[model samples]
Target: MGFFSHTEKLPGNWPSRFHHKCTSKKCTYPNSPQAAEGRYVCLGKVNGSPCKGTYEVSPSDAKAAAGWISREVEREAEQSKKLMAHLQEARRRKDDEHLQLYQNELATYKRVLQADAEGDIRFIRQYIRDIDSVALFEPERWHTHLIHLREEVLRLQRLVRELQLKTMNT
Candidate 1:
């Protein structure tokens, strides 16, 4: 599998910056001051143990970043799902030809997303093209939307966690 490298975005004094040794679980790293020069110790292993990694942030900072990315991904997934639902409904209404064309376009867009080293936000909007082509029509059920949204949100959260870990080590 291909790996996603985040070296460019990560800071140098990682592990220690976000997580410190759990000397007292009750008193978390809240009282700890911000890192300087990317120097943070790794609390995951031994106390005051220096680690090497990049993309480090304070615990709170990491939380904020994760939340931001999660929200964005969730929104994207929900939009994609809405488009898919529209295509489905259109097909049911004897618009199979148009809907099939959208499916093809969606597949191509997914490929573009995978291949691009840096994602083009402009093309992201084209997902709307897929829906518009089919004259998008779908029952906007809150539960279904939430279900799809959760998938992308969790995936983005994982990515945030991985980036945090990376910062801690470098």
Candidate 2:
């Protein structure tokens, strides 16, 4: 039986595949290892050929992977908090366009958080890639953009008020 064939019986809802960098010299293939003979072995292909790289599995290696996953979840949670703040500001300003954008972003973040909490590594990874592909994961950029929009809205409001006053005097 192959290593991945028995992955459904593994404990802790671990992912069926764990990605590890190929250690082969001058080989740049991205390696994904599955358990074999009590250790993880690379099963990746290079240029349509099988890769021969191997990685030894250790307790510390498992711990490091878990830690990395936890850190990603935490970072996403922090970004969600920032998104909530932006959503509230959008509501206060009655800015429907930004309000809708923030709402959609928060919904996506919620799904990512839920998948991470349920230990669905595959879903989380895919979702993250989808987000990264669109370059929408930067909370700092969103914050700056919101500030600029707010300034423009205020400037336009001031212009309208000035026009109203001029018409009243004429």
Please, what are the lDDT tens digits per residue for candidate 1 over residues 115-137?
33365545533543444423223
TM-score of 1: 0.24
- Which candidate number maximizes lDDT? 2
Candidate 2 Cα misplacement greater than 4 A, ranges? 1-19, 29-38, 50-52, 95-170
The total of clashing pairs for model 2 equals: 0
TM-score of each: 0.24, 0.34
lDDT of 2 by residue, 44-152 (tens): 6767777777656556556655666677679999999999998876654554454445555555555555565697768855764664533246656544544554565
In order, the Cα lDDT scores of the candidates are 0.43, 0.54
**Candidate 1 residue 164 C-alpha distance from true site, Å:** 54
